[model samples]
Target chain A: MRIAAARERKHDERRVAIVPDTVGRLSRLGVEVVLEHGAGAAAGFSDAAYAEQGATLTDLAALAPDLLLAIGPPPGEVLDTVRPGGLVVGLLGLATDDAILEAVAKRGLGAIALELLPRTSRAQSMDVLSSQASLAGYKAVLVGANLLGRIMPLQMTAAGTLTPAQVLVLGAGVAGLQAIATARRLGARVEAFDVRRAAREEVESLGARFLEVPLDAAEGEGGYAAAQSEEYLERQRALLAERVAEADLVVTTAQIPFRQAPRLVSGAMVEAMRPGAVVVDLAADTGGNVEGSRPGEIVETNGVRIVGASNLAAELPTHASQTFARNLANLVELMVTDGELHLDDELVRATLVVDGGEIRWSRPA
Target chain B: MRIAAARERKHDERRVAIVPDTVGRLSRLGVEVVLEHGAGAAAGFSDAAYAEQGATLTDLAALAPDLLLAIGPPPGEVLDTVRPGGLVVGLLGLATDDAILEAVAKRGLGAIALELLPRTSRAQSMDVLSSQASLAGYKAVLVGANLLGRIMPLQMTAAGTLTPAQVLVLGAGVAGLQAIATARRLGARVEAFDVRRAAREEVESLGARFLEVPLDAAEGEGGYAAAQSEEYLERQRALLAERVAEADLVVTTAQIPFRQAPRLVSGAMVEAMRPGAVVVDLAADTGGNVEGSRPGEIVETNGVRIVGASNLAAELPTHASQTFARNLANLVELMVTDGELHLDDELVRATLVVDGGEIRWSRPA
Candidate 1:
């Protein structure tokens, strides 16, 4: 079977779904690889590199293969090129968009989204979001550290002694934990808080003190935080306010999937911080946890600085791309064999969203 | 000897240098404690709590204590009340504030900063910065996860499958590493990059891929990235741009003590990323490693978000305050005896910045 990897239609998405290294790996597995011209350029792989890796260079029309791989869902034009019963795989943010799924079903095409893999131990190697969020977490701390007005570690010298800075992290998820570890390494004091009880041990294990607030834990299946009651949120806010006032830096990361981020830090809390204090809101895209936070903007309140950043992983590209490639490679290796596709893997079956002109798996009706 | 615990001078600070539990511990150590009324109120302790813990509530001027424990350096008024040869210990960020040290020296007082403890294994309990930074790192990742426009892990449904989000972490230091681990736990694909080669194993051990860039491995004495030549910076930037273009989120945590953060992400590099991408900068207060990144502001370049957060630890305040209190208590316990004072511990020697009108044990020149 032949597969075609094409350019992403989404604006600013320079990364091709398949890279030259993966092409070599695919070739070793006996799968025929085809590429649209310069598909990997944005990620630093040239068409020549794809050729060197044994992938055939062909025009889009001539390279119409059984499967299509893209960084995002296939655009209308690309979707029209797929053969009946063929598969298209990539990031299909289907919850927000239904047209793509309709298009796949209309075309009698099989589509799998890499983002929907379950958080199970057996699916660890196939997990892509964990790989990417890890990078975003590490990068956020470096950004915060760069903007801090004072140094992190204390020093004693004839000139005078310098005190270490204080840092507070709101969410104890992947990105928040990484920020704690990075800030600690830089010699800053760190503290973290999370609603999920399971997160407490992880936070403390990283050597960060976990702030336990009196709030009802509402975690859904798979350990995701479910939406909470207003009363619970208010109590959580009151408990957190005293701590917020004492921090020199605060990073808020609490968010629920497909929902607006819960408002955690209030206006009074921001007002209570020092003049030069800074707050980084990671939930700005979904309505921030901090009051007066605007997505992609900085709001200064009572001399305290509030930053609402939308996406944090793009700041470090080289590593991000390499990790993306590795994860994709691992997934590809699991689905291909003897230079052909193995469509029967349980992993593939689990992720297949649409096939044979119908929606195949279970989801919100 | 008589000792007084004064109120913190900083308007936003609420944590007292000595908490009620510690006051009880100090009382058992033969240390006479005089506390300013309402000193521990901000940290959720009442005057009655201090009283119950065996602390004497007294006016600052009338106390004339031989030792003073303060959350911050003593206010000018409190300092003026101290007798010659009195000791003052607290969270004085002396490295950045020379005036406080001068005040201690001029008054012929002994001053010790709790943040100056070494990072050896034996000193882990006394490592106040590590305790706080660990929390900061954990919280930073949570912030990023919440801000991200999509879910971290992939999910499968009959409607369609969701793709995993990609996360990039800049700097493999403590915070960055923790960010990597936290993001991984949340099911994001994580990649970490650091200038220090020593961090590779640590990053990898956490199950995150380490980005290896070709560069001179010139780590400083403390295993930090040393100041590099302009040529090296340029090379680092070029290499980083390739990876940044592919990430959904990027967290930057690289910084040098008392120096501007190394410029890592440029405007051109940011322009290459997908729209809705987020960047959380941990170095905004000093200067940002990302060009066009404003401290405490989210600068949107071609739809890419740059977040420069200053105080990440403050976001997780309850735990941060508790850990900081414990550190302060431990440091004081090392020098106080049965509600009294001792001036002869090696730990005290290392932390004491000024004593008897001179810079005692100051690092050579």
Candidate 2:
């Protein structure tokens, strides 16, 4: 089988699905590796590097490989280049990317949506969502600190003692936990809040304070947050407002999978924050966890800066691509049986959104 | 006595010599505080905040107080606004800002050049250079990390283990030491170089390895690096080339006081570095320590980014202003004796550059 990857076409998408290391990994599995020219340029991988690892560089349309890998669903034109009955694997958003999935089925191709990968111990190594979200959390703290007028760590010098900055992280999922860890590493006094009481253990283990609000658990499937009623959300926001006002830097990552992010901070809460405070909303690509956050733009209100982080993971393109490529390689290894392709693995059954000429996805009950 | 500060005219100067907290401190010293409109605005302090601390806000020309405070030497127009025999105090560069000093004496103003303050224990609390350089060092690492494509710290994610970034610091001054400390705080493996062998203790104390080039100590006055011969510099650069090539990030802070900064990283050495490596030159304002570094801008050569960081402490405006104002407050307190001004203190004598139409400054023997 021939495996290929093409350059992502989105203006802000900097990650590449395949890297030189992974090309070598797949080639060792007895599959031909091919990639379009300049595929990994944005992620700091040169075409020469891939070629040196024994991958062929050519136009995606001309190659027509048996398997295609991508960071996201490729454009329709690029998808049409794949041979009939071939396989496509990527973060095909099961809920939001209906148009692309429809096109995938019409083209008589089998597709593996990484987003549909089951959250089990066996699938941990191939969890792209967890891996990508970890990077986004790390980037959030750095971006917030850069934008703030003050420094993060407390400083004691000849002039005087400068107290450490107060950092508040909303939600305790993969992204939020990473943000807490990063902030703590920078010597910030970090506090995190999560409706899932189980997250408190992870937050406190990172040397951060876990805030407790008087509410029931909002646990959903696969450890993601469940939807809340308007009454519960309003009460929760009121409780969080105090913490928001006290923070020097706030990173909000309260995203419900495949749904709008819960609004944790309101405009009034932001106004109460001190002048020069910074708030980074990692959920801006969704509806946002903070009011007044605009995707892909930084806006200032009442002397506070609100960073609408659209793609925080993409900022660290090199490492993001490397980790993602490793995850993809693991899934590819599962599809190979006795040096030939097989679709019998449990992981394949969980992630395969489309069988040849048929769509296999259904809404969760 | 009346003390006044005006808004700095330089567009890039975000620091203010006075803050609201310092205004309260100065007021408690029995002096009238006057300020030009929006004097502290750029430093994240508001006019309302200053007024609340008992400061009088008006135009600089209108105030014409008994003492004038500034971050740099005031221009001829601002000097003209000060009353005859008034005192002007700030980080006045004795060698470069001669034109302004001449204007100060011609206007019969006594000026305190903070840069000329003797490095003694008595003057430690009032040492603005140390205070500001410390912030510059902290900011250099942040700028370098933000530009690079990889994370600074080591990670053992399920995808794999990522090694920590190797940070090489070329200088062991207050700024360089701070850079080492900050990088260590972010979990990067750090190595530092300094001509003064005494710096080894401080570097190691901050959990960083000190690179010792095969050279004798070049210790200068006041713990600064002394001038070196051309042959010595060439040998030093050759020794450092290997470390520079291995570093994911390099922050250069090797500046000789009142002299052009020493050239450290040559262009040839930079070309040998990996793609996406970042170098932040803290001495860019005087003269860059790295070749091809443009002051106040980021330039790219062979896919390596060179950030000529001019006034990096200004990037942390709020905290910088707070520390700077506190230092200035300490110096102001030394000038006052029992509700009256005194010019007899050792710090006052050392820092007072132009005293009543006469220049007390002579080159240090």
Candidate 3:
């Protein structure tokens, strides 16, 4: 079987699904790896590096492989090239994009969407979302620290003692946990909040204080914080506002899959912050968790600087691509058995969006 | 006696010589504390904060205090406000600018330049250069880490192990030591170089390797790494070129007092570095240690970023101002005893630029 990887067509997307290091791993899976000439260029992977690993370099249209891999969901034109029963795999955005799933079904293409992979110990190695979110969380703190007008670390000089900056991270998930860790590393006094009780332990384990609110853990499907009731969200807003006002830096990573991110920080909270305070909103791409956050823009409101960072993982393309490519390689290795598609596997069954000329997986509305 | 600090007039200079925190200290020196309105505004000290500290705010030109305190040497018009026989104190740049000293002599003013303070244990608390340089060094690392296109820390993820970034710091002064410490804290593998042999122990104590250059320590006047011979500098450059090419980040902090900074990282050396490598030139304001560095601009040469970071301490205005204010206060307290200028003290004699209508201290030619 021929497995081909294509360059992501999205303008801001710099990550490639298959890296040069992963090329050798896929070759051992009893398949020929074909890549578009400049597939991994943006991620600092040269075409020569890919060729060094014995991967064939060619045009995606000319290769017409039996199996295809991508970072984003391939457009309609890309879907047209796949023969009947050919396999297509990527993040795919199958969580909410019904049109892409419908197109795959109509074209009789067997598509596997990594976003649907189960959040289990066995599937952790192939969890692309967790890997990318971890990087986004780390980058958020760096972005905030760089924009801040004062030093993050405390210093006692001949002049005077400078206090460490106080950083408050909202939503203690993969991204929030990483932000807390990075901030703490830079000698910041970090505080974090989460709807999940389990996140409190994780936050504290990284030497950060967990902002306690009088509410139960709103555990949702796949161990994520589920959407809270209106009353709970209101109470959360009130509790978080006080912490936000006291913080020198705030990093918001509250994201709900396929939905508008819950608003946690209000404009009043931002206004209460001292001048030179910085806020990095990681959920801005999916309709922010902070008031007045515009995606991909850094806005100064009153004295506070609010950065709406979208696709922050793309900014650290080298490592992001390496981690993402490994996740793709792991998923591909699981689904391909004896150089052919093995759809009966539980992991494969969970991710397969279309099979045998029909839509096989149900997407969340 | 009246002590006054005015708003700095130099472009891009945000630090104030005195802050609100030091107002009470200055009051203890048997002097009335008066401040120019908005003196500490850029450094985040509110006018109300200064008022609460028992400082009277008024126009600088109108106040005309007995002693004038400033960060930079004020212009002729600002100096004109001070009554002849009154004192003016600051980092007066006596090593190079004789015109300021000549003007003070011509005006019969008692002037003290902080840059000429003796390097001794008693004078350590009043070391403005050391305090400000320490902050500059710490900031250079932060600036480089933020601009780099990759992560500084190593990560062992399911994807693969990402290596820690390699950082090379040139010069081992207070700023260089601080840069090494900050980079080490961020989990980068740090290496530092210096002409002073005493720096090796300090560098190694911070968990960074000291790049061993085969040469005798060229100790300069006043306990600094003095200017080196042309042949010695050529040999030093040859030894550093390979390390410069190998490092992901190079922070150049080599500077000589009142002279152009030594060019350590040649343009050829910058070209040898890999694409996306960053060089933070801390000496850029006094003529760069790295080739192609412009004082206040970030230059990209052959895919390597060379940041000409002059007055980086000013960028961290809050702490920089606090530290500078304390240094100024210490100098003022030492010089003014019982409401009179005590020129007999060694510290006072060393720093005094003009006394009794004559240039008391001759500058280095």
Candidate 4:
């Protein structure tokens, strides 16, 4: 179907919906690709590249396509260019922003949020959050490595054998695994932990050690960790005091949907660790896993440095934009037909959080 | 050589250096084992069981074995019972404690800390940290699942299609991978990341997608991520903001040796996420990955919950203790013989952080 990919309205976003390579892939799937001029410039894709790939180069007003694809929710002015009854798809956080919801409703536009897609096996290929989070996870480690003072792997040189840096990862999702594998490859002794009992094998298979504890039954369900009872937490703290004190580096990535971050690290724990240890808090933006964590700030306490960096994925814009563009392309391939659009696909239906001019799935309000 | 298995000093520690079954293995190696009353109680092993397996039950004062085995460092009074020139092996953080070092010297004893074992191929079996960390990783996800407010997997119930929770893991080490696999088994959509590019395959092999990024050539000699320029960090942050905003749950696990945690998440990024989201910082002990994280406290900001619970491994102490005991047992099997000890093995030499010692391997002044 015909889709107009507009420039991302969010400042500092280098990603674009329709990269040149994706335009060719979409063209093969009978889709007409439209690009806002220079949309892919920040990502190193030129407008001419889009034209070479058979995409129609046109202004937003001239190319009033039936569907709009964007990296984020379209800006207000850009929404004005949509034809009536058109569909717009992107990362629409409809639960919080009334303005965007109101804008879509006023125009009777069908809007779907990639972020709102239900996480399921069948929907995995169309999941944008997975795609982007993977990128974020990969980047977060690099950010941490760059900021850390010492090297990760052990080295035997004529001067002396340099012991590998000890790395502790806090979570075991995609990003955490990547960090573990990455750290291990770099010769760093990597260790990680998560709240999922089922994660032990995967962690061990990677050659990294897993940290275990006697968690309350309430701490686990269906393999995912549940919010712990206060008593369970106290016991956890008492048991973990020594382990935390021994680690050289720590990375924390633990979060639950639409909730505040769980405090896993304490000031006492930080105090217990040796000075100059670095912690990368992936949850800094949401809150932090560390006691003195501040988003986008480097905090030093008792000679220990805590860096709260936000948007780790954005740090690697080139690859992030490429992956995002590919994800968008896959999503478009699911609904495009003969250079036109079909909004009836289950993939589209499921992710259509704001359709028929109303907020259909608003995270239970 | 002969060795004495002592009672655990910590009240909750139930594991002994040798289980009944393993005692058979040790006896075959010409090792004589002595038990001190109730060493294996927590692991369901009785002194009779050890005796049945060819271990001798003896009083500490009479045993005066060449090797002493216990779950933590040998208590001060217990050191007095060791024969001069005897060996003591366990999970000892001697480098961090002057008391432990002094005790080893005062007693003229050879002390091997399992935690200090080098991350070498030969030391794998004796690696206490790896064994325990692996279990900790598995349990962390279970803990998170128990604490999570929703189910991990998708279900097609007659009521409606239940959506799987979106789980984001912060680190990619052993604990992180276990968390990913555990979450996946429970039906949650799991995503993970790490700094080292080498982790991509491990993450993908587990059915989770790996996030890729454009990283600088900052990897250290052992494939560890080396520190990067500030410009690189800014770029990274800009990219991760959107991904963090979309995740329902985030688990952070990033730490550097001898340093404070690096802040991976920003407050604005957390604010950007939908309310009611949850974050668990596994690095809560050494500080956290979230901005407003507090150790052992669940902080809510603008409708989001931040849980900074440290020492997740301790939450599953029963299993943790079991694994730790197994590791200790394996280590004890390496040097104890005929109710005696041998301290000349390469493994012992490398792990003996304090032996007739005075800060054997002190941190740089």
The prediction achieving the highest DockQ against the true structure is 2
User: B1-365 in candidate 2: lDDT tens per residue?
Assistant: 88888888777888888899899888887888988998888788889999999999998779797778888878877888888778999988775546666778888889999988888888889999999999999889988888878899999988997689999999999999999999999899999999888899999999999986544544435223323657666766676999999999999999887888988999999999988899999988888899999899999987899999998888899999899889999999988655467889988987888899887776553
Model 4: how far is A353 from its true place, Å? Answer: 1.7
Give residue A283's error in model 2 in angstroms.
Answer: 0.3
Predicted structure with the largest TM-score when compared to the true one: 2
Off by over 4 Å in 2: A214-236, A362-365, B214-236, B359-365
lDDT per residue, candidate 1, B1-365, as tens digits? 77677766675565566666667656666767788776665555567877987888876666677877775677788888777798887767654465778888888888887656666665666666666566556656666655554556554422124467788899877678767876676567888888786898999898888876554455546223433657666666676787889888888888765467987888888899876678888877668877888866777776567877665664444345556666766677777765556768877877788877676643333
Separate clash counts for every candidate: 135, 0, 0, 198
- Sort by DockQ, best first: 2, 3, 1, 4
C-alpha lDDT (0 to 100) for residue A341 of candidate 3: 65
User: What TM-score do all the candidates reach, one by one?
Assistant: 0.50, 0.93, 0.87, 0.49
- DockQ category of candidate 2: medium
Complex DockQ per candidate: 0.03, 0.75, 0.52, 0.02
* CA lDDT, candidate 1, residue A145: 51
Winner by lDDT:
2
The order of the candidates by TM-score, greatest first, is 2, 3, 1, 4
Q: Which parts of model 3 have CA positions greater than 4 angstroms off?
A: A6-9, A56-68, A73-88, A93-111, A213-239, A337-344, A354-363, B59-63, B76-86, B93-111, B213-239, B337-344, B354-363
**For model 1, what fraction of the real interface contacts is kept?**
0.00
Q: How does residue B75 of candidate 4 score in lDDT?
A: 82
Of 1 and 3, the candidate ranking higher by lDDT: 3
Write the residue-wise lDDT of candidate 3 on A94-115 in tens digits.
5446677788788878888888
Off by over 4 Å in 1: A57-63, A155-158, A214-235, A299-303, A361-365, B1-365
